[model samples]
Target chain A: MTITITAFERSPDGGQGLARDTRVRWALEEVGQPYEVRLVSFTAMKEPAHLALHPFGQIPTFEEGDLALFETGAIVFHIAQRHAGLLPDDANARARAITWMFAALSTVEPPILELGSARFLESDKSWSAQRMPLVKDRVRDRLTQLSARLGDADWLDGPFSAGDLMMVSVLLRLKASGLLDEYPNLSAYVARGEARPAYKRAFEAQLAVNKPPAG
Target chain B: MTITITAFERSPDGGQGLARDTRVRWALEEVGQPYEVRLVSFTAMKEPAHLALHPFGQIPTFEEGDLALFETGAIVFHIAQRHAGLLPDDANARARAITWMFAALSTVEPPILELGSARFLESDKSWSAQRMPLVKDRVRDRLTQLSARLGDADWLDGPFSAGDLMMVSVLLRLKASGLLDEYPNLSAYVARGEARPAYKRAFEAQLAVNKPPAG
Candidate 1:
């Protein structure tokens, strides 16, 4: 069955590969699975058709034959579970890796997202400047713990897995904020993830869509 | 192998079942699995010993024999995968159910958590009053979509899978805020989850720990 997934017609990030479709693409690349992308405009995303697939009205919904799934974590995990390279063979190791995946999304990403909402959604608000530090500090607290745990390690656990993939993707949001730079190991960790051949391919794929056409 | 999971020695919620451990316990109960709970103090959660088991330094870490896991979503998922009842037998249905679990934690819960942090962490800030509407609106937006999707359905997808388990848990946080009441269907949805025998057992177990002794 041919795997089909969705992406933003024009990403809000303008091809930074920060959009979640990049994560799904990266997962597919890591597993050496060929897939197709269906672009959905922001308006189309909220339409009944897209909402049927993703109640949240987000991109990167996966479809293979009768299976339809959403949420980048779930999409990535589904891909990882069916494929060999994204998860470990050992059951215990695989469970730990999945734990990291949840930690990345549930524990770590929430604060980072709060920071984004402060910067973008509420940029014009009266309290934006004053409240920025509190939001950033919240993110810093999480990063501090993550950095400590990641001390002198290559990937989160052992070899690269979906956990690292999700964590790196979550941390990448903080690159512009410079909070990730404060933790050198985490910065290096993100760099290593970016250095992966699969990541590069995925990045380029999303970049191609967002790149401006020549006049 | 006997399964052991950790919980907060004294839950900050006073045993309302808002703690992530409740979610894990509920999953175990749904699958008819008996598990042991080990309590961890807040200070110990941050210490290296507990951090080794849970890098993020939160409660609800699962240990069985030599294998240990953290993150409630992952722990619940592990139980659901190994045991019956929490997940569907159909591969596609199972994937969709897991998708709801991710949706619960990643999409719905993030905004709710922000509202929590705003109310609890930033309550003293000058901007709390002004900024709260924005945070609340963010949650309302997600719930509106969720309520729409859930219209007249007992569960998000099908017969009381982990998807409903997670979505219900996430929605329960909003009960105190009164936001959940705005959507009658969602409020009913959560009530339905609470009405389940497994959920009741899980709730009572946590309540027992947090309940004060009678005079």
Candidate 2:
């Protein structure tokens, strides 16, 4: 079924692919499944219409025919499950890959998200500086173990799967913070995910929406 | 295969069933699956051995023979996938249930966890009071929509699946804040989750570990 997903009318990151729709778009592209995008404004997000699709009022809700899905991890997980390229065939390895997806979002991403919340929503707070390092450290500590486990390997576990898709997505948020550069292997890992033709297609798709209007 | 899961030797919450392991334990109980728990002290948790199981230095790692998984969501998902009753049979409903799991962790849980971090880790800061309300409002916003969607329903979708298990676990974190009471439906919903025999069993099990040593 051809899918239609929502995106931030304009991502705060200026088309850097922080909008999770990039991951969904990338997954669709990887499986060579064409889809449509529905850009949502901030005002529209708080309304019941958008909340119906995403209870949290977030972007990148996926809909196709009778099925509607929210939560980027779940959407991407569904995409990976339905599509061929995003998951592996081996049962155990596939489970491990799925574990990585959870690890990326549940473990690694939480602190990074905390950092973002501190910077944007709590920047005026006097403790931003003090609190930020602790948050960053938590992210780095997780990254350190992850990087060590990864070593010089290209992907997280075996081959490219939804795990890598998610891990790379989590790491990208740290790029602006300069913390990701601390781990060369992770930087290269992010690079490999970006280099994927599918990732490129997805990035371009999100960029198209968030890119500045014509001169 | 029999599974062995790691839990806090002494849960910080004194096990009022707030530990992540409680969710896993409840899932096991719900599935009528007997499992083992391996308690790890804080020191052991940070050591290399435990770190291998959980990079974030946390408890509730699941091991079923050769298979090892971290992240409560992944472990719970694995259990639900392998066993019956934790997931819906209908494909669309199953997808939506899984989506709620992601929504619980990525969207709803993050802010709640942040509120925890802010209280425990950053409470000394002067701006904590100022930042807390903003963070709380974000959480309330999510709960309002979730409660609206749930509305007098017994469970999230059709049945008592892993989605409600996850959503309830996330909401439990906010129970003490009285923010949950603001949405009476959500407060009642959490009570429903707690009232489950599986949940009671899980909570009591964790509480045993949380209680202080014999005097």
Candidate 3:
């Protein structure tokens, strides 16, 4: 059966890889997996049909035969497991890569998301100005630790695997916030991820969909 | 070789699983892994020895033979991959579980952490009261979707797996906030996780370590 994924008919970021689906699409593209995308509007996302596949009713649900999956981490992991390119060959290295994957989502991503939510969703609130700094500081705290550990490395762990992919994706959320610029190495790290032909393809694809209706 | 983990000698939570060590302990217990805990005073955590193992200068770093790992998600995942119980045998089911782990950390946990940050770190600020409701609403929105999906279900996915462990851990963060009570199913769902024997062992073990600082 053909692998199929649902993506926003138009992403809020206007095709920026910040959209969750872009991560899955990029992962598939990296693995050279030919697939189809089912575009979904924001309204359709909340409808029962989309909700059936994704309980939270979000974009980027993966379906292959009887298998249906949500959560970009899981989808990327599935692709990595099924196709060899995204994972390392050695068992220890593979385990380490997987560890980085979890680290990306669990440890690093939390503060970044907070920074974004505070800036975007709460910007209109009375506390936005005060809250933004606290949130950004938390993000910086995580990044300081992560950057120290990553210290002069091309990727988070040894070599780029799904770990780096997910980390870069999470970090991209802060692109507009200018906080990422505080860490020169982290900025270059994201550039490296975006430079990948696979990521470029994914970026362009998502961009094509959201290129309309300028907001 | 026996695995060793670092934890707070006197936890701020007074042994409540709010401490990161609790998650690591729960994962170790779930995997039937024999491990020893090394208690670190707050000062020691900032020192080089602890910082070398965990860049964040936090507790619950794992060291076994040559391998040193931090981040609860990474540690729990390492435990699950090495052991049999926490992951599924089926390829797709395993992917779904892993997805929940990511969702727990990335999607659900961020807002709760924001709540924590708002309540503790920023509580003294001039805008604390004004900022809280905005943060609470975000947490509630995430809970609403998650609770709706998890309605009438025992776990986040099929049976119980590491996914549930992570999801429960994420939900536990909001227990004291009373915001969790806004979603009855999620509150009950957290209660169900707390009732597990393994969870009991994990919670009590951490609680014992930080028991009132000898008061």
Best-matching candidate per TM-score: 1
Runs of candidate 2 with Cα error greater than 4 angstroms are B213-215
Candidate closest to the true structure, highest DockQ: 1
Per-residue CA lDDT of model 1 for B1-215, tens digit only, reads 89999999999999899998999999999999999999999999999899989988998999999999999999999999999998999899999899999999999999999999999999999999988998999999999999999999999898999989999999999989999989999999999999999999999999999999889
lDDT of 3 by residue, B1-215 (tens): 88998888898877678888887778778878888999999999888888888777887788888888877887888888889889999987888898888788777887888788879888899888876877788888888889888989999888888999999998898878998888888888899989988889989988888776555
Model 2 C-alpha lDDT per residue in residues B1-215, reported as the tens digit of each score: 87999998888888678889999999999998999999999999989899888777787999987888888999999999999989998889999999988888887888788888878887887777877887788777778778888899988888899989999999999878889989888888889999999998888888887887789
Candidates by DockQ, descending order: 1, 2, 3
- Overall lDDT per candidate, in order of appearance: 0.95, 0.87, 0.85
Candidate 2 lDDT over A12-122, as tens digits, reads 889999988888888888888999888999999989899888877788899999999988999999989987998899877888899899889988898898778777877
Candidates 1 and 2, the one with greater TM-score: 1
RMSD of 2: 1.6
- Which pairs of residues clash in candidate 2, taking residues 3 or more apart in a chain or in different chains? none
Clashes of each: 0, 0, 0
Choose the strongest candidate by lDDT.
1
Candidate 1 C-alpha lDDT tens digits along A14-39:
99989999999999999999999999
What candidate 1 gets wrong by more than 4 Å, as runs, is: none
- Backbone clash pairs for candidate 1 read none
